[model samples]
Target: MKAPAISYWSLQLLLGWINFAMTAPMIYLYLGLPLVMRQQGWSGTAIGLFQLAGLPAVLKFVLAAPVDRWARDTAGYRRWSLVLLVGYAASLVALAGLDIGKTGFTTLFALAMLASLFGTWADAPVNALAIRCLPETERMRAGTIRSAASSLGAVFGGGAMLILHDRVGWSWPFFVLGVGLLLALVGLYLIRPVHLDTIATPKRSEVGVRQWVGYFASAQRRRWVVVLMLYFPFIGTAWVYLKPLLLDQGLPSGQVAVVAGLLGGVVGALGSLLGGYVTYRRGLHYALPGFAMLALVALAALSAALASHASLPLLTACTVLLALAMGASAGLVFGMMMYYTREGLTAVDYGLQSSLFVLTRTVVPMLAGLLLDHFGYLGMLSALMAGMLGIGYWSLRFVRGMGEMPPKMGRVA
Candidate 1:
């Protein structure tokens, strides 16, 4: 018998908590740890090497294959999630037991790397379970919730954890996060197992490295991939360099952190939720082109501001516009990722697309940095603006070709 549908908001709440839990330790590793290390007078090289902890995220596609092969049903995915979440939480608790000041940097680094590995590996099954269980109608909202949860995680990991560390010490931050993860694990159990038609019987022969190549084999998927590649990176690059641009414009570092870091994150979260609502109301045909156009305008405005050496007020306005665009675009993009995921191969497909997404997101910033050095802010921003304009036009044409907005959920195009 088909399992009864789970409550939509309850599912989102559980998934959002998982997203938040997975995200926090990563934020701590990337943002919080560096600050503490720097304060401890760690060498620049050592601090730089700490970034290696995130390497596992780049290999998410590889990590996902095992889950796809082994976890053939919603129940199996849930089991994997439970086991992985346990490891993730335990890693944090283990880290809490060690003293950063006394523990060798190597030991601390290894533990953090282990935490990242578990977190990255765990995400695949959690998302696969989400994809399987969530009705097509709720997919966009799932994306919104995921995006918002990630932002809140950033605030907790990057901001609050740092404060906790200062007030109580390093151990407390990890201990607090560890306890939170355990609580999330308990909540995970409260969610009754759901079975969906989308969960296919395991076909061991079809599951392998070829699954990665098969993802892009469809013409419709290829067109969708084009949209995915083009959608977010330009605006993402701009956001990456926004802080330095503000500082160059004479904003104090503290003020810059408030405006760019704190304010930008909060605005991005609200924008994500609002974007999901807009997509729900207007549909993907409208939301896709609408967000692309908004992004184009925001990029143009930011470039013009930079070129003219605009005042802080004008710049701040542009910053808010760009952040909103970024957040909205992120929601739509994430939703589409879920949209494109193949039913039987949920984990591997999502992992492959996500790997591509991360690769471009990472590469663009480096290229943008080069542009910034050679052509300055105006040049870099203008270049991104031009890219967005082209991508935006292409997206409009592509959506027209799709024939309807938000293709019937879970029907393979």
Candidate 2:
């Protein structure tokens, strides 16, 4: 019997819910945990080292190999997702049993690291499943959904979790997050698995090293890889440092939190959705160039505002523009990544691109910090603006023929 076709919106919502569930706990670990540790009188060094718990995310490509090797069909991918998500939820529930106030740092850190590892590993199968199930026409919407879900996750994980801890206690936050994850798991179970084309089973000889590295075996793939690395990181680095800039400009900490944390997240989410709609209405050729232009304008405005030490309202406007640019660019870049993923090796290809995406996003901030130290805010902004302009030009030229490329069924080699 033929299964009922799932509507596009239904699939996006389910995928977005899964993304939200996966993201919130990690955000809590990264954002909420540090604040708690600081309040508990933990040393700055210890708290700094706690950030290492997130290192698992950067190794997604390596972690994805097993899923690609084993989960060669939609049903197999769903099973892998269930097992990994169980590990993720179980880790959170376990954390709920540990009292952070009296627990040893090593114990808490180890548990948190395990949670991150499970969450990171689980993302591969989830995304591969999205690629498998989503039609080519709806891929951009899927990216927008991810961006919006991530923003909501940040608010819940970074903001709501901290508030819960403040009003209740440490364990409640963990408990609540675990419950949320399990709810998403229930939702996943309720949705009937949709079978698309089956991936060809790899021969034993083709299952090892070549499968891992085959994503980079072609020139066109390499070009897209460069675009993946460069396109969004410049704007992203600026967004990362925006809060510090506001503080330096004499905005109160409370105001900075509201502006950068809450307001920025909402605006960014809206921007992501809008960008996706535009991309869907026009073509990638039109959407990519338009988004690149928007980013450049935002960067220029931000630079000008910083250079002049503009009024509070003006500064806020500039911040909103930059946030929107960052969000819009992310929407486009994610869709592009999906567009570039190979058919048979969806997991491996998506993992490699995502690894590079995350790696560059991580490293560029350190370099940006150095630039800020050496050249001040104005200089750093100028450097970023120039870099964006250059990269934008190159990306447009490189992707000029992206419309000509097949949206579905990319060649493995």
For each candidate in turn, the TM-score is: 0.93, 0.94
Question: Candidate 1 on 1-413: residue-level lDDT in tens?
Answer: 44444566887888889898888888988888999999888889999898888888878888888888888788788889889999999999899898777878799789989999999888888888888877677787898889888877887888889989999987898888888788778877876654334445555546776778888788888998888887999998999899899999999988887788788888888888999888887777778888989998998998888878898889889989998999999888887788787766888888888888888888888999999999999889888988888888888887778764345532212
Question: After superposing candidate 2, which stretches have Cα over 4 Å from the reference?
Answer: 1-6, 195-205, 406-413
Tens digit of lDDT per residue, candidate 2, span 212-253? Answer: 677778778777888889889999999989999999999998
Q: After superposition, how far is residue 160 of candidate 1 from its true place, in Å?
A: 1.2
lDDT of each: 0.83, 0.82
Clashing pairs in 2: none
**10 residues in a row with least lDDT, candidate 1:** 404-413
TM-score, model 1 to reference? 0.93
Q: What is the clash count of model 2?
A: 0
